[model samples]
Target: MRHLISIAAFIATCAVLVWVFLPDPVPVETAPITRGDVTVRVEAEGEARVREVVVISAPITGLLQRVTLHPGDAVTAGQVLAQIGPVTPALLDSRARAVAESTAAAAAAAVELARSQLVQAEASLTFARAEADRTRALFERAALSQRMLDDAVLAERTAEATLASARANLAVREKELDSAKAMLNGDYAEDTACCIHVTSPVTGRILGVRTEDEQVLQAGTPIMEVGDLQDLEIMVSVLSREAVNIAEGAEATITGWGGPDLAARVERVEPGATTKISALGIEEQRVEVRLSLLAPAPPALGHGFRVTARITIDMAQNILRVPVSALFRSKGDWAVYSVEDGKAALQIVSLGRRNDEFAEVLDGLTEGATVIVHPADTVENGSAVEEKPLIGG
Candidate 1:
């Protein structure tokens, strides 16, 4: 009887120890539903750009002379940027002189063509001037209306400009003819002849110089890019599907520009989509969104500065919300493991607009209600739970 009592007491002590050593509280973390404001936004990477980019091109074909301007150099309107002059005439040999004679003949024919055009332009101008004089006299006598008189005056001015342009063309053709003759005589002095100065069209800093060295270029060849640094905009490429939600005048918060956050607004959403290779080597359909800064941007930030954009598409105030991890699909319906009396109770909940961090709870979950975030498979309805310290507390 003494052995039986001792054994029973020892078994009771072992049972107590087993109860004390049970796994600590399932090792699960918990969060509570709360009332707060939530902003629905699409985050994207973007780059800073100029509001207006201008390209200064070579207006006339010639050999480009010394270009003193460099990138980032301040320039003003009408300031000379570069010089273009005639190409060098090659030294004449017996074969070269024969080629030069052919060129001279072609230049002479061009001069004749230019002279005929000048004569036609002069005749038109003379007629226009005579008609204008007659119209002015009639207007003075109240025979012609002011509109007719103005028309005649405009016609005369246009004709005069045409004639002057024709005369200039004739002079250029004559010079070409003379130069051709000089080339036939083995004169290579055209290389160092007078040059045409290329002037800046706008007051801004040079962004890029396409031709840094002297070289022969054709007319309309691009030379440099100039833009005002103070005038800036942003270019954000977002997924085409997400771009549909964005509209003009939507608010945007720009960050990661190596400065403080800046306020901006969407100016335009491009109508077209383009294919782009993502960082992960996946192809994505993307659309460009243009935004204008609401406040002045940082002075140090220049064109092509990398940035991150958070565009707010929707919002809600004083909405009941919970961490999105607490929600799970149950029978094709949204459900959550609600903790009540320290037990996991399955509760069906309605949801509304959601963001990356939180989901808006419409029903079944209330403020101060504890919900199991990422509940384990064993955490089911009517199961006892020991809540660990709150996540991210």
Candidate 2:
């Protein structure tokens, strides 16, 4: 009985010793190194703008009539948007009235002279015709020479041409008289005002009105702006140094534009750089990167809408990758705690590229190898680890 009791005690002691000496598994989350594809992107905040923007302007120097259309009003081509009349003249006094009357009288006299000249030309033409008829009859009867008949015919044609010229002169004189009368009454008065209707040149919505009321404006003054909402492009301004990495035809992803993520492509990188004040109040050398939408942009995406853009600068396919969280500095080299046989194994990895979530593993890791993400400070090489599935896999 003593021997059996001693054996039982030794066994219990051995069990306690084994339980105390054995290491406990460290709690950790891990993900297997993946071999698939990864994309490297450069991100920026961008602004949406119409591909084409047009400013409507007054074509003539005149009073700018009140614009009834407000901002964001849809318009079509050739739609009359505003009407401008010639500037109304100041009040006319006695001396001004006298001068105007004298000018009107001169115009009337010019018209009378033209009418008299036309009447004279008509009389001369009639006389020439009679003479030509008589000369032709005499020539047929052998009573007059051929040269005389020819001369009479020529005179008749000349007189007819003169009469036509006089008629043209009379028309000009009448127009001049009307113009003088209009000026005397008032420039652009109710009866004789020359009103010009300004029409929309294209189909679009009104962006803004430069002149809102009955303000006098000079010729070519901007009155309004129009731009198609459907035709939209993304303008991303990036640092000039970073722009060198962006190339035309790179795939761009746009988000936060009041719709689904829009697929786009880099259409152009401006050759010139502009200076812009950043949020930090530092002057930044920036270049514009224009993005062309791959699909039709949403109508809600209007001009100056804010958006975020991610441009893919590089891509690696079928390359081994690991979560960026798994990477840590060890012994002056990039390293990770790779799980092997349920123990954290220190690994020195050669990296190629990295993005937000993953880093390209050029060497020192293989597919299906699990790596501890955000390894704790207490964890070290050969530490027993308990693996938890990474969130979202």
Candidate 3:
């Protein structure tokens, strides 16, 4: 019995020594390499806007009547928008009145002279026509030459042209007389119906009323803004570095405008860069990227509405990829801890494109391979590892 007890004691002591010398396995989280579509996207806040914003302005300086139109009011072409009444003329002094009366008298004399000239022209044209007829008759009877007949016809044409000119001159003189008389009488008249009607030159909804109250305004003063909702588009500003990668016609996904996600496409990229201050107060060179909605926008989406745009700058399909958290820098190259047979093997990997969540694997990885995610500093090459179960798994 004493010899058996000594042998059992020696076996237990050897077992403890072996366990103390063995290395502990490092706990690690692992993820599988996937083969699927990988997309590189640039995201930024954007605003919806009308492509064409028209500002209605006053065409003349006058008393602007109160505008009855409001924002979102529908308007059509040639619709009367507002009325600008002519300002009341100042009462003329005695000398001014005298000058105006003299001008009116001169205009009246000019009208009389023009009317006499027009009557003379009419008589001349009638005589020319008679001569032309007589010359043609004489030429047919062989009493006149073809040249004489041509001369008479030319004379008649000239007389007709003169008659038309005299009639136009007489009409101009009559209008001048009327204008002079108006200038003299309007200064003294108490009541005159005179106003310019402002009309809408487009078909759209009023975006805003710039001058809604009655007041005096100068010509070219803005009255209101009009825009069509059907021409709504999106405008996005991105960092200049990212803008270089965005191409025209690239697809984008829009969200956060109180509606479902909508699809859009890049229409253009503005050539100029604008300076903008970021939330951190840093100055950034921002470039504008204009996008057109692929479908009609929701009714709630209108001008100046805020939205988020995720633009696809690059894409790769059916490619091997892994989570971005698995990648780390090593010796000036990208590296990852690839799991092989319960061991972490440090691998240098070639990558193509990367986004926030995943990266495209160009080489040094295969689909279905396991990689350590967010490896700790203690995890090194040739380290023994064990899969750490996720919480609640």
Candidate 4:
């Protein structure tokens, strides 16, 4: 019995020694390689804009009346938006006033000359008509030659044409005299009836008004902007490199504009690149990409609103994928520490595409295989490892 007790004590001592010398298993968080769809997307901030924005400008240089229409006001084609009237004449100096008076006098004299010419023409026409009638009567009776009768008719027609020309001259001279007199008298009264009405050329809501107060404006000055809210689209500026990958008609999603996620499609990617200063004070070449909302946008969505855009550049289905956190560079190649048989196995992986959360595993990984996520520096190949429970799981 004593000998048996000694042997048991020796065996227990040997077991304790082996247990003390053994290395502890390294705790690691792991996830199984998944076979699912992986989408590669590019994200950027964007703005909602009207696809077609129309600017209404002043048609003539004049005194612009106060605009009654406000932003967001519904407008119809040919609806009167504002009115413009002739500007009040400036106060003229003595010399200028005298010159204007002389011009008025000259215009009046021209009108009188035209009127006298008209009277003389009418009198001549009457005399020629009587002579032509007599000549025609003589020709009919074979008492006068056809040539003489033709001369009389020609004179009568010429006199009638001269009378008509004189009347036209008189009317033109009278208008010139009236214009000169108006300038001399400075008689531009402020009347809405005489104002030129500015009308909207489209049926839509007003986007913006340049000014609401009455002021003098030159012709072609923009007064307001109009656009259809229903035709809203998004404009996003992305890095030139990323822009090259985004194809026209690619699917996208929009968010962060005080609404639910909205579906959209890439309408176009601008060919030209623009230099932009980034928030970090870095100069970046960016290209503008246009996106069209697939569905009717919310009623609140309007021009110049902010939005977040995520454009899918590539996609793969039924492929092997793993969390991006598990990936790390090893010897200038993509690698991950995959857990196998309670040990960490280093894998040099061939990757295809990646996004914020996941990466496509082209090779060196299989579905249902567990990989250590965010492995520590101490982790290495063939190292003993144990799965760590997730917090709150």
Candidate 5:
């Protein structure tokens, strides 16, 4: 009876020990959940560009006799850039002499002719008045016949007509003399040999110098380019489907092309979509978006510099944030497992802003709550769990 009793006791003790020490239903490894401020952002890639680019060209075709400036030279408005050609000494002298002689002779002739015409017109007018006065006096005194008075009046009229014609001729001569003077004063002289100096249209650094010494340039050919480096913008191409959600004034973070990350804002979303052929020859619709750098542009930022950009179309701050993998659909509603006391308690959650990595927890979860990421499909609610480090932690 004693041995049997001792055996029963030992069996009972072993059962108790097994119940106490047997591995607590091997707890599945889980990551410790921690939360802080989370930021949601959209990522994109693009290139830096100047806000304004001006292409300079010669207004007339001529030999580029001199290029006083070269590429990268700083210039101001109206500053002379280059001189084409100078007037030849012989031609200049010839033009000067011809203009001088012609002008002097023409001026003398004009003055003499105008004086003569004025004197004649004055004499005619005086004679006509005197004859009319004499005719009136004769009629009053009854000493002259009416036919004689009339004949005298006709004579006066003829003299007046002649004076008028002379005055008109004098005016024409005066105009001709003025024109002759202008031509003789080198106004009509062709300065074909003189260099046509090109001037800067705007204050900027010359980006290019197309012509060297004595190169002939055609009209409207671009000779140089000028741009304001201070004012810079970024142009990015986005997938057509993604572009629809982007709007003007959206915030963007630009990075990776040589400079530090920069903050930019969308200036415009181009309306037109273009078809792009991929390496696989698949047609893809894309749109170009222009972004103006809000921050001061770095000196290293240059035109066509490729960059990676993250455009923030949506954002939220100071919210309960959880890893996106922790979110799962439960009966058409979003749910997550809140790990507490080494167990996952399935809890439905209301969510707010979401980004590529995290989802904002609006309700049913608090900051610092441990949540299971990528919970197993077989894992049941209120199941035991063991904490494990995340891969990238």
Candidate 6:
């Protein structure tokens, strides 16, 4: 009995020692929960591009004899922006003299031909009338042979045909004379006008100039460019995955371009995607999206300027919101660890209208309630934790 008592005492002593020397659980640092409005935004970086750019090119090939206007020169439609090589005085004088001589010669020849044809037609007509009278007189008196009267009638018909032919010839000569006169007038030589008068097609400033004085340009070469700065737009390219969610008339906010945030609306989403090689050498499908500013853009903004855009895909007013980092997948449901007296208490949450950084808290949490952000896996119901201040809090 004494030995049994000693064994029990020894076991009791061991149990007490084990309980007294056990290590305490380690404490975890947690971010403090704050209450404020949280907005979820989708951010994209892109360059600004003009909505409409007009490229002015030479209509025909010639020496760029003059480029009187420089870039930023305001011009008007039909204004002579530049002039090509001018025609030499000697050439012009020779062409004029040749035309005058040719025209005079054609006129003299035409007049002579017309007079001769008119005289022939008149003579033939007189002869035909006299012959017809004689034929009638013979036929009536019966003093002439019938064959002679028939022959006289045939002669009169022949004379009439001759007169008609002569009149037709005169008409042909008149048309020929007009053609000859036109040729002698040197209308074709007026093509030299192409050497001068390069006019502006639209009233705007010159954006580019490709040629200087006396430079020869090929056909269809662009000599200058013009664009209306008042008409401006923002063109942004987005990944195909992101583009699918974007649609026309979506609201967007533009910022980080050296001005106040500007409101913009999506005008169009391009249908096709272009393949672009990323820095990793992976091909990405990108689609262009066009946005129009609802308010006037600052004058300082120019083409190809880089800016940040936040597209509001979803939004809700007066809805409970929580930091996105607080969300965790628990048993196939989104959950957060609510802090109560510096202890984590597991709570299931229903979310709605989630943005990039914040999520709308639809249920399970109230406003001004403290929730643990970035909860650890070891965190559980009734877990002891200490709330620490968040960065930038």
Candidate 5, which segments miss by more than 4 Å at Cα?
A: 1-38, 65-71, 82-194, 209-214, 278-282, 325-352, 362-368, 374-385, 389-393
Question: Which candidate leads in TM-score?
Answer: 4
Question: Model 1, range 88-114, lDDT digits (tens) per residue?
Answer: 756777887888899999999999999
List, residue by residue over 1-393, the lDDT tens digit for candidate 5: 999999999999999998997545324444444565666565666777777778777777766666667866788988887665543223337767777777768777876887797788779878887988899799889988899788878878888887888878787887777766655554445665666777877887776777656676777877777776678888888888888888789989888877677888989999999998977999989899998888778877766678987877776666668788888999999998877787778999998878878887778887667777877865678676776746774
> Per-residue lDDT for 92-123 in model 6, tens only?
36767677677768766876887797787788
Least well predicted 10-residue stretch by lDDT in candidate 1:
185-194
Give the Cα-based TM-score of candidate 6 against the true structure. 0.59
lDDT of each: 0.88, 0.92, 0.91, 0.92, 0.76, 0.74
Report the lDDT tens digits of candidate 4 across residue range 1-393: 999999999999999998998788899998888888889999999999999999999999998999989999999989999999887768778898899999999999999999999999999999999999999999999999989999999999999999999999999999999999988888444434559999989989999999779999999999999988999999999999999899999999999899899999999999999999999999999999999999987888989999999999999888889889899999999999998899999999998888887889989998888899989988999999999743421
Q: What is the lDDT of candidate 6?
A: 0.74
> Lowest summed-lDDT stretch of 10 residues in model 2?
186-195
Could you estimate the TM-score for every candidate?
A: 0.72, 0.69, 0.67, 0.73, 0.56, 0.59
lDDT of 2 by residue, 227-280 (tens): 888889999999999899999999999998778899999999999999999999
* Location of the lowest summed lDDT over 10 successive residues in candidate 4: 185-194
Q: Which prediction has more favorable lDDT, 4 or 5? A: 4
Candidate rank order under TM-score: 4, 1, 2, 3, 6, 5
The runs of at least 3 residues in candidate 1 whose Cα sits more than 4 Å from the true structure, single-residue gaps closed, are: 1-22, 98-183, 191-193, 328-333, 374-384, 391-393
Q: Model 3, 172: alpha-carbon shift in Å?
A: 23
Q: Which of candidates 1 and 3 is the stronger one according to lDDT?
A: 3
What's the number of clashes in each of the models? 0, 0, 0, 0, 5, 0
Regions more than 4 Å wrong, model 2: 1-24, 90-191
**TM-score pick, better of 1 and 3:** 1
RMSD of each: 13.4, 9.9, 9.4, 6.9, 10.5, 8.0
